[model samples]
Target: MKQVVQNYKSGELAVLDVPVPGCKPGGVLVRTAYSLISTGTELMKVSEAGMSMLGKARSRPDQVAKVMQSVATNGMSATYRKVINQLDSYTPLGYSLCGVVEQVGPGIDDVAVGDLVACAGNEHALHAELNWVPKNLYARVPDGLAPQHAAFGTVGSIALQGVRRGEPQLGEVALVIGLGLIGQLVVQLLVASGARVIGVDPDPARCELAERLGAEACGDPASAAVENSVAEITGGLGVDQVYLAAGGGSNQPVELAARLSRDRGRVVDIGKCRLDLPWNAYYEKELDVRFSRSYGPGRYDPEYELEGRDYPIGYVRWTERRNLACFLDLLARDNVDVEPLVSHVADFGDAVKTYQRLKDGELKAVAVLFRYPEAVEEGEAEAPSVAVPAVRRGTSVPAPARSGRAPVRLAFVGAGNYATSMLLPHLAQRDGVELSTVVTTTALSATNAQRKFGFARATTDLDAVLGDPSVDAVFVVTRHSSHAELTRKALLAGKTVFVEKPLALTEEELAGVLAAVEESGNDRLQVGFNRRFAPLLQEARKQFGARTGPASLRYLVNAGRLQHGSWYLQQSTEGTRFAGEGGHFVDTASWLLDADPTSVYAVATPGNEDLQVVLDYPDGSTATLSYVTSGPSGFPKETLDLVADGRALRLDDFVRASVYGRKRWVSSRLPKARDKGQSAELAAFVKAVRTGGPMPVPLESLVATTAATLAVRTSLVSGAPVTLARGR
Candidate 1:
């Protein structure tokens, strides 16, 4: 139950008690035996995390650009909240580990429970007691290899990939320009390929270890005679290939590799060293230079790592997974010995101190391994999934467990920024509302949320929350990909459900959710379309109610563009903005017109921002939404203008409104804070739960809003208007 976590803001490391992760489909849960500490990569992360705000920005310019843009649009106050949320998060560490399978998820039959395997992948194979690893990121360890030795499989594959890039032939001579753990492994692998190897580093101990591990020769790069030594090792013809496997702030490794390589020789870089190359040094010799990607051919492909899709052996013989299997085979045959490379074996409980020593250079670790508690050979330890004991505020029992006028007991399946900042605060103070449980995938947040929000229990299991009799309704505020399934599950569990915007991403998922809602006879389902409830918008709607002519509304959203690698940009996880955040606008437009969108046409500039969508209604009214990212940052995020019967009302960020076409123009401003209608929305849901009344947002309206959003995406793809299917 203990996992290693680091605070990104302080770079503080600790071992914390956390709940075991649920087994997801296409993956297997494993109890860790030994996990290697990547000194080079992890130490850099620690140092960067400890940097000052300005320092951190200097280190990552792309992120700094995003922050500046956010400040431009949302003002300084709102953007600060977003930045703080990101910085204060607790992140897991380590990626190469050996473990025994504890549970197998659906579609994973290659390995079963109790099988010893080597696991890779940053999201999985973390330095924890238990991990959920995808099948492709795991390979069976050979019978006789020790857990400590097998844990080096991922690192060894990385070394193997660098050698493969060099294209070293049999009887060739290669120079490994770093005597670190990876450099030592590179030398041994080159020897296994029948090539004479030379290792170079500044540390004599590392050089000596490399020589002992099958390097024909070893030299310190700091030594003035190192270049001459390489020439002598290769019979005055220079090395046929050079593998630059050093990590430092200096560009010497790259310069040295280019100097020592023979004419037309290949130089493969696999380290975090400076990439500045001396063109003249290699151009004169006509040398070939290539940088080796981590592991091998399938490094960053989601289909290969997370989806269990393997490259055909005939087409790609040495994919990342295949390279893992090959390294284990070599270890089995005694071709590669990693025993001497391990400098320390620390207990998992003392991982924090071990990392401290490693970071401060107090411990010389070639490959430090964290040994876990003895794993059971039969069936692994049962993953912890029970609900945490309640922390009672008073002697009163929760409302769902009591009789008359009891408060509605609620459990939240996620604790994201929106739920924490917008929803929980209002619900916590509301009358007849009891916050029962809060669940998340990690521990620190769950514990933090429990203490901060006055929740009775914190857990990592959804089943525990769903099965609790004390819980009467569930809030689904997780990522978009999880909305449909989790909502369906809660409905089946006979609990009311309230999910955030964009009920479902696809038509099929929408249908499934609607079916589940029908099956829950008396229980209600509500999607968050909070804009319709905003006081300003509601007032505008009342004025439009008296008008008889067709209306035209224009919604402008200055949604800033996100940089690459942001979680929001990953459509599979977060869904497109149209299906995720745009639904709120669609619902607002439809609710104001009191008509279902009959057809939609859309177009967008590059990066899917600067979008223009037109929705046609059955009542002959039309709404135009211009979601532009290229707008100036000082502009309000959302601005709406509605025109009907020669009267026009303009709303600015839900904080101020102006009406035109009167004898004199009238304007009103909210007191403070833009009212996005979040409070009113939650109040409505609570009222319905207490009174057993109709769902706050009609199911048909939610469905129609989502259907229209999906139709916009379809229209953009086909470059034509997309008609909605009846009843969707």
Candidate 2:
């Protein structure tokens, strides 16, 4: 399906043909009829993308801090590659759309196929012909409501949520600061709720439009008439509540809201702007200040969004999905009219230029809508697929193709951040390895990976790579949920497979992968436990290899808190950081001790805090991992301490190691790069594939490490120590 995406590096907009995403459990696949472009939100993204690197940094200090942190932890070169990868990636746009449900994924019971639904969620309801929206992010449109107007449901929900925060009651007077698309909707909602409304904005046209939509009065925030209009509308008293729905970098909206609100009244900010309110303004008035999050209550809860969990109506009356449904009901009942707010309507194919026009001020539109062609006889939208020329995001090398030597050819299925940053660069440097094909979901990434890493060809079809007999290996760096299926497919296709950590999320998937490994003759699968091959760890192993006593290992991981809606928190995709990241430490400890863990126990603090996991080995050895997200940022992310045979060793963030016993010595930094074992692991896997040697790590160890990691989650939930069933 064709989707509109923006290139962050160059701020180039393009409608490119991307693979139709598969419907996962707890979601419904929708064929988009109409999707609305958020002028305030999308325009900011466009403006940010168009800025220079310095401008970008100034605009987003939070991201700059993250980059600095990356530089501190991963060194300059690795952080540079990660930042470049992010800049070159394509970011999809649009968060609200009305569509026909084409398919329903498993575990979703709310909507059926053929239902007309309005989809929300920026990550789900993108401006694409087809989208997979979670059950909680989509609602069935009310009967007789036009799909075009239903596309406004998400924005309407935002407006409704802001009004809800304002808490306007009958006979109350409220001020809506910013008469943009949301402000207009807010006006209608407040008026319908029996509240007299005054709309404020700098644009006269928007003010007039708000007045036409039943706002008691409208005025420019910069004009003295704004305060006069509010006083007049409220009979010389300020508005009972001020809803700031404006979008800009100015702090005036906040100041205006504070001034226009009556004493002890409420001011709710629903927009993205500078919030530097004067202390006296609120201090004297004793006003209440609150900010409304996007949509409603379930906006960022991964359990609510991805796992189909819902808050009871009695507990939480208006969730993000309920807000959408309520907005659709209002539209159908004629209480709210969004028809006049849509200033422009473009075909889905022209969405790129529409965004450009909107950003360049060539189009005077408040709400821009993109219309997809009606489904034809085949039940598919009639939108034409856009032909994007193949181009790599990174550097291009005119290297020669594979000669008669025919080195071990490798194919990479997912060219995401990890593959592009760590794996691909090292693979590019290897001698007897060939980057055969790059298969990614999007055309831009496929082309870029092919060009940058010298892949033979770039394609979106994973089957092409698996079917080719010439390809000797496949790397599965996609989502954790797909590791099992991809690895099984690659091994069955007679190719060596190297999958990233936490090999499979569930024991059932693990069993299937183990079956595949056994069928593939036992030397084809290698899990990414790169820390075992780190130069520092290798030297430490040499010191502790001959120890007769059980060693005590303590690993401290300062895994900073992930944002609420981050993909890492989405259990369906990444399955929490425990399954996603904790496996690395688990596997590393297993390799260092050279002993499989016999039991695992884990406990965590509430609200994204510290987690303590203990692993017990058969030789009475124990490894303790303290994973905390609330620690100071300056601390090293990973630190290791080991004690055995009257000796102690400390490894600080994998950069340096100091031994504290009779063999007192220290291994410090490498002259050029921090050797985190990524290069060494990749080289070992390639050599094994080429020389028919044993895999870098034994298959039994891979299975045991995965089983132990899975046991950690079980132990945390079961509140008991879980014993591993793997044989020694």
Global local distance difference test of model 2: 0.82
The local distance difference test score of each candidate is 0.80, 0.82
* Residues 1-728, model 1: lDDT tens digits: 99999998887788999999989999999999889988778877877887887887877777989999999999999999998987898899998999989999999888988888999877898999999998788899988676777999898999999988988889999999987878889998998899988888887667756766667677778776677777677778889988888886799988888878888999888998887878888889998889999999988999999898889989999998899999999998878877556666677888999998877888776878787866322322211111111112123222232444888888998998988998999988777889999989998888888888888899999999999987888999998989989988987777778999778887667777766656554237889889988988787666544668888989999986554335564453456766688998888898888888888888665324467999888878899999876688888999998888888878888887776765434457777888889999998988877776777977767777877887765555333467665641
Candidate 1 residue 313 C-alpha distance from true site, Å: 1.8
RMSD of each: 24.8, 24.6
Worst lDDT window (10 residues) for model 1?
A: 382-391
Top candidate (TM-score): 2
Instruction: Pick the lDDT winner.
Output: 2
Please give the distance, in angstroms, between residue 463's alpha carbon in candidate 1 and its true position after superposition. Answer: 70
What digit string (tens of lDDT, one per residue) describes model 2 on residues 1-728?
89999998999899999999999988999999889999898899999999999998999999999999999999999999999998999999999999999999998787888899999989999999999998899999987776778999999999999999988899999888888888889999998999988888888768766776677668777788878887777777788998888877788888887888888999988888788889999999999999999899998899998887999999999999889999999999878877557666677878878888888888877787787866322332222211111111122212223354668889999999999999999998688788999999899999999889999989999988999988888999998878889898887677778998768886668777756655554347788889989988889778755778999999999997654335564442455577777778988888778888888887665322467999999899999999888788899989999899988888888778888788687886757666789988998998877766778987777777777777765554333467675432
Which pairs, if any, clash in model 1?
72-633
